[model samples]
Target: MKYIKEFEKKMNLGSDNQLANGHVEQASIPKENEGSVQTYVQLLKPERFYMFLEILIYCIVGHFIGYLIAPILKNYFYNNLEWY
Candidate 1:
């Protein structure tokens, strides 16, 4: 029984060491925006600036209207309120 327990413990330790090594290897590679600075900066160009801004503004406006209406409708419905 003691030998079996020791053998299992050794296998568990080996698996844990392998997982740690795998994580270390994964961390050594460049990730997302951390890799290249210029590539991310180039994404914001003059030609696409207005287009991006326009889409952003539209999304913001839609969100704002939805925010304002959602609460009011929710409250009205919960309170069973209606008007002619």
Candidate 2:
């Protein structure tokens, strides 16, 4: 029990690095899961929200392109003559 608490405290202290402009580094506090249902949510600060959205859009577009290309290529080969 004692060792676990120390480990957790060290992990929670991860954002204490210094910035070049003398700002204390900080990040979102972790949230706890709801009982039994296994669902939880984090309220993102604005900067984090913007970064999240940017990454989300990139992932969505990348997956969409992959999904579109998969069927088109499959059909192109399936429809082509074996000699070609």
Candidate 3:
């Protein structure tokens, strides 16, 4: 029990130290102006374009699947219809 408490105390201290260091580093960084076009361009990485292409391909595939399945679903539902 004592050993577990000590271990937890050490872990807590380590996390606090890390948090303090992060705050210091964050304070040291210069604030970027929000209106900078250069910063905006830099933020638009090539990975974003690749992600967009991936999403677009998935959307097109989904549309094609839905189109192919629609007729089958419609026929099944129509055939299974019961008189009210």
Candidate 4:
């Protein structure tokens, strides 16, 4: 458990550094004030896209696991426990 926690801490720090670097790089790039669409496009860097993908995958996997486990838990509680 301690090793898992340590690994998670290091991964969080690495991601933080990646995000800080992305922000710094984004700030260094100049954008035109022509329209909101163009500005939004400028903000969509590749690293941000991958980060978004990672979040999407995590969400999908988490929901799938929850869906798979829900019925078993429901059945167990329905048969083995009583609620008032």
Candidate 5:
């Protein structure tokens, strides 16, 4: 119990009472227009485009790999493996 208390004190877990007593600082709220959807859309416009391009490339590459490997595996299994 003493070790747990010491660990909590080391980790600042016992500061909840201090926080409740107004030692905690609050985050400033953004203005109504600052946090609008239009602002977020503007911020994320390029990122969204890049994300879509990345997903499309990944899907194309995955399909290419699957198609390239499927026939090779099928040929190898049919030619080399014997099922009794």
Candidate 6:
């Protein structure tokens, strides 16, 4: 029993009974940012700008495709259809 207790102590398995001998280290807490609101506002500005750019690109591409397909369809209908 004595040998088992000594073995447990050597393996640090008696942690529940042992008192801490060294200085206890603590985790450092992060400080709150005072300009966090302003930072978020700044982040949103670029997001809005990118969203506007994406919408503009979609509009331009859609109009360009429509312009290309319109003439081809018009010519096909004019040649193939017999109008009374």
Identify the leading candidate in terms of lDDT.
Answer: 5
Question: CA lDDT of 69 in candidate 2?
Answer: 100
Candidates 4 and 5 compared by TM-score, better number: 4
Total backbone collisions, model 4: 0
Q: Write the per-residue lDDT of candidate 1 for residues 1-84, one digit (tens) a residue.
A: 677557657656334323522222222223575667665564445657889989999999999999999999999897896665
Once fitted onto the true fold, the runs of candidate 3 whose alpha carbons sit more than 4 angstroms away are 1-44
Q: Per-residue lDDT of 1-84 in model 2, one digit per residue for the tens? A: 677556656655324453434344653333453342323232324677889999999999999999999999989988885963
Task: Estimate candidate 1's alpha-carbon lDDT, on a 0 to 1 scale.
Answer: 0.63
Model 6 ranges with Cα > 4 A deviation: 1-44
TM-score between model 6 and native: 0.44
Q: Report the lDDT tens digits of candidate 6 across residue range 1-84.
A: 798677767766544433344222432222465446664553355666999999999999999999999999999999999989
Say which prediction, candidate 1 or candidate 6, comes out ahead on TM-score: 6
Candidate scoring better on lDDT of 3 and 4: 4
Better of 2 and 6 by TM-score: 6
Residue 8, model 4: lDDT of 59
State each model's C-alpha RMSD to the native: 13.5, 11.9, 9.0, 12.6, 10.1, 16.4
Of candidate 3, the 10-residue stretch with the lowest lDDT total is: 21-30
lDDT against the true structure, each candidate? 0.63, 0.62, 0.66, 0.68, 0.70, 0.67
For model 2 the local lDDT of residue 7 reads: 61
Residue 52, candidate 3: Cα error in Å is: 0.7
- Looking at candidate 4, the ten consecutive residues that score lowest on lDDT are 20-29
Candidate 1 error regions (>4 Å): 1-47, 81-84
lDDT of each residue in 47-77, candidate 4, tens digit only: 8889999999999999999999999999999
Cα lDDT for residue 67, candidate 5: 100
User: Once model 3 is optimally superposed onto the true structure by TM-score, how far is the C-alpha of residue 62 displaced, in angstroms?
Assistant: 0.5
